[model samples]
Target chain A: MTNADTLGALLLENERTRPTKPAIREKDLGIWRTYDWAEYTQNVRDFAMGLAKRGFGAGDKLCVAGNNRPRLYWAELAAISLGGTAVPVYQDAIATELQYVLNNADVKVIVAEDQEQVDKVLSLRDGLTGLEYLVYDDSRGMAELEDDAAVLSFEEVQADGVEYGRANPTAFADAVAKVKSTDIALMAYTSGTTGNPKGVMLSHGNMVRTCRTFLENEDVRESDDLFSYLPLAWVGEAIYSTTVSLMSGCSCNCPEGPETFRRDGRELGATGFVAAPRSLEMVLSEIQVKANDASGIKRWVFNTFRDVAVDIENRKAEGLPISLGAKLKRAIGEILVYGPIRDQYAFRRARWVYVGGAPLGPDSFRFFRAMGINLKQVYGSTEVSGLVTLQSDEMASPDHVGKPCPGIEVRIDDNGEVLIKSEGVFQGSLKMAGSALATLGSWKAPDS
Target chain B: MPAASTAGEVTLSVSGVSKYFGGVRAVDNVSVDIPKGSIFSIIGPNGAGKTSLVNMISGFYTPNTGSIIFQGKDITALRPNERAERGIARTFQNIALFAGMNVLENLMLGRHIHMKSNLLKACLYWGPNQREEVRHRARCEEIIDFLKLNDLRKQSTGALAYGFQKRVELGRALALEPDLLLLDEPMAGMNSEEKEDMARYILDVNEELGTTIILIEHDMGVVMDISTRIAVLDQGTKIAEGTPAEVQADPAVIAAYLGTSH
Candidate 1:
């Protein structure tokens, strides 16, 4: 919308507009470190130049495997800035499972978060003949491999890139200018329960258009804080944390580690939240446990107000008018129970919270809504760049996912299967020619 | 007892050390020379005085009859605090971390010997004191990252699982950055997976940091697999001292500790 067609261009735009604004924050060693937009762009540029110095360019694949860390996000943008596609492997994936995805994606360069991921990748080195460089962010427990020819630290690569940039001043910008909007940006692998995971290739145009359209339909703000705790391998994370934050100029917060998510989430008080159904269930379970362990009077107050909130939600959903007396009671309940509960769970500033990836249990869905969280269900998959339909704010019931996103068309076919047609629809799956062609033919033209 | 036949310089030398608890001879004339940068394991059956010998070396119990030299200095008369200052760190068989403190705080407490600021200076919190605090915190963070304790760094030690508590103890000991480390059963109550993780961390400390480790564990498989040299004790007396292969084949060690089936 702003003449920035690709994600790299959007990043450059953010740096030009708000150079000093905090673009990302990561909690490390019990302290939150903020990197402004100017710094973020500098990191992306240096890493891009570094990759370019090593013969990485268009059609190459760079794999990022690790938890939600700021360096990993920069690595993703660095790959894209060099006109190469970024493939994120799940951090919890075992060695053999990792081997399949690495081989299938034809990854040439890898940016591992720490020694754990580096070890996993090194274990499969025999089969990964295509991989040329192994870069790691944290160097702890890696003293033994420092002299290896194939391995390099993140700082070392950046330093090399700095030297290269000095020699060729405009090399990074030139490469970024070469990245077309229609170029493949991300390749995410499915879970592969039935077979090997398929790589869904989404173009820069696909991701940028989808995020822009969703932002137009929603109230996401430039001042919002988005928490990036989900696996980067998921399409939802790619859209929400990486693309959406880059486009909207919001700050993305990454927790210190997996165990610190709850504490860090509370500290950041993020304005945007996205989680799968299982994570929503975990939140509900935590609240229930805390409520049960509360003092007698506090528990009584919680249970009573919870019922009131649920009653109000149900009446509102069923199109029943609330009496003035009931409205007064609901307002009092919000002050007494719902407000504190929301604050405790770090939903106080949450303007938009979504639960997707699967249908949430009705009880858990209603429970969150009752606590004053606008918990909405989204329905989509990796094939659609993570957005086909989204529940509106006023839609409270979990019976169906809300209407289709702006400019997207969804229709049921003869076999009772859903078909989506939108600009966000991915180009095709990599290495599966038959299914890729079949998928392209299945998307019928919208009945304009 | 035969001398440890390793090639490196001896980091800790215990010559005919004996600790007596009233009438019970907890440790009777035990001698072991632990080489630098080696994983030295001490194995024995119940009541074999392995812990007693470790307690004497760590200065919790002074040897009644023998002198202990660490890094070429006799430390037999030093107190526990003095020994800790001399680069000796130990983790208990039972977790002894401060129950109310978080993991980071417990590990930070391990750096008490290294802090130079007095109570008054620390209370003022200016200049040198603040820098000292920051330095110690950074060291604690390194240990946290090394032991993979990032997730539990802020959780209370008492609330952690048993295996995690043991790991936290190990982490606290590692925070000392000692030249000689004594682990008196770091993997006592862990399942196989926890045992494997603890064993890996121990080897990492030995190989990566080059700390001299004297491990007292009951798991024979772990002891045999990771130890550079083995010392077997029976009823407060040294029975065999050699490499794992030599100790495993020794008839006296097999009859005393490893059963006939082993």
Candidate 2:
């Protein structure tokens, strides 16, 4: 919980303290392949060294576009580890959308996922004047890729890094030692539902503080397992799955693919999970759809126990005492309904889950609570590294997105807009590049 | 001619393949180089001999003139089962699953070419057969899990809906663990949502499983979305072959299939 915590230092500490503990696991072809803290750090080192060999140095931006692969997360850390900034774009972004992000950031190197993304980048290469190299993760159909020097597979780069490390061992460690707390770590582009997207530049200190605050305030611990199926471009994913995992020494599991997410979750028995409101609604509606076609007897059994559980929840929330009979009925409901429902959705081990990005509907919120799932609402935008206020367990409500998290001060301005100040707040957006010097002048003044 | 078996190299190549039904030439000379781990689609109007080309690759029909090279091996004269043994799996334009069999059983049957337990061990249901069955069941479960068909694992194929049956057929083909998968109109008879789902699954099988796919479909939207490259077949003659964007822009393809409106 140091004030000057950087992601590189956090990872180094984790590697030194818990080298054998699982840091990341990816389900590939129906098997969970784990990389311990040592291996995790090694991969990051290799990636950073690889970039260094390719002329990627301080202040360079590496654009990442891919599914939530372990390599993508590590690439982000690798860039930050080398005093560079990582910019991740949504995997499904169209050509025009990607063009805006890449061009705005003036990214020199782009690490894409597969042939689909490689094609998109190559097609837009003529428009992107600054782009120099294209690093692809999956090499399928890449034989036809036209450019030789521009296109390099992830494996090829890693191999180059390994060779470079063999030739110069101390260089990698020296680079890591140079990374400071205030250095920009990653830039997250907002979804831009309203208008054009903006790149929010977050520092290493911001991520470390947000993760450390969340870790200390919540029930999360070293033993907690997180299923990181969310888009890597999202700030929440970086905070929870990457930074938090590094800070807490917990294992983060990447699902095999979108189709096998539920099965992967069940296999991991993840204790902590996070999602946006829309994702939660989809989960609840899927459950409702399944329950709608249930037979009369089954529905009656489900409903009777669900009522008991909901009653117990309402009484608990109201500060009223629950009777012994009601408690027994709730237990019965747990066995008959809640247990199976939770097991089916792979929420059996879910001790803490969060829904954010928008206010969740009361019906879905209450439904998860009634089923004894500790679902909470988190309130924040990407500009704050995705954590400002979080609903505490005892004060859980669908409407209110809870009190301010640790180290955050909130106020309402005369214009009726909520303003928050926190260590986790981003340095600024890339759009403010030209005005940075002017802003710094006023920022350093005692009275303005 | 045998080519080197290299990653991302041509996994299957059809060299001037021609097929004839007596006097009628069902398929004229056609050549396509299907790369490894790519979704290569064949599209045209009705009666375009797309199925005949698929049959020739799957060994359901022998080519009158040309050879099929797969992984550097010439397999033009191979039988269907022999081709299946060599890691070639395909689904039909029409549903070809056994209606009487349950979903699990149908999927398990796809592994028949891979099973090697002796008859005595299979009948005894002990030792090698038990271990083999367990191994195969686990593999089938992976396919089922991949396809999200947990609810219909035990239901008869006939009792399931059309879309479910199509998914089951895909699951069966996936059970074969093939390196090359041929899907013929996998989204046919499905609604928009189901079509989207099927398209995603197809992409998953191609990208995740690293399977080389040759697809034939009438739905241009799904094809354009899923396929890395496409070859247009108009009236049994190959006209254009390139990336989705290139194929979409090809004048011959636009004139023959997409029409002037597109």
- lDDT by residue (A129-199, candidate 2, tens digit) is 88989899876557655358889988888888999989999877687789888889999998545567878
Give a tens-digit lDDT track for model 2, residues B1-262. 1111234688899999999999878899999999887888999888888999999999999999999999999999889999999999999889999999999999999999889987877999987789999899889977887787865677899999999999999999999999999998898889998998898888778756778899999899888887888899988899999888999889998888657763
The best candidate by TM-score is: 1
lDDT agreement with native, every candidate: 0.89, 0.85
Give candidate 1 misplaced runs (Cα > 4 Å).
A191-194, A293-296, A395-397, A413-415, A434-448, B1-6, B20-29, B258-262
Give one clash count per candidate, in the order shown: 0, 0
Error of 2 at B131 (Å): 9.5
Tell me the lDDT of candidate 2: 0.85
Question: Clash pairs of candidate 1?
Answer: none
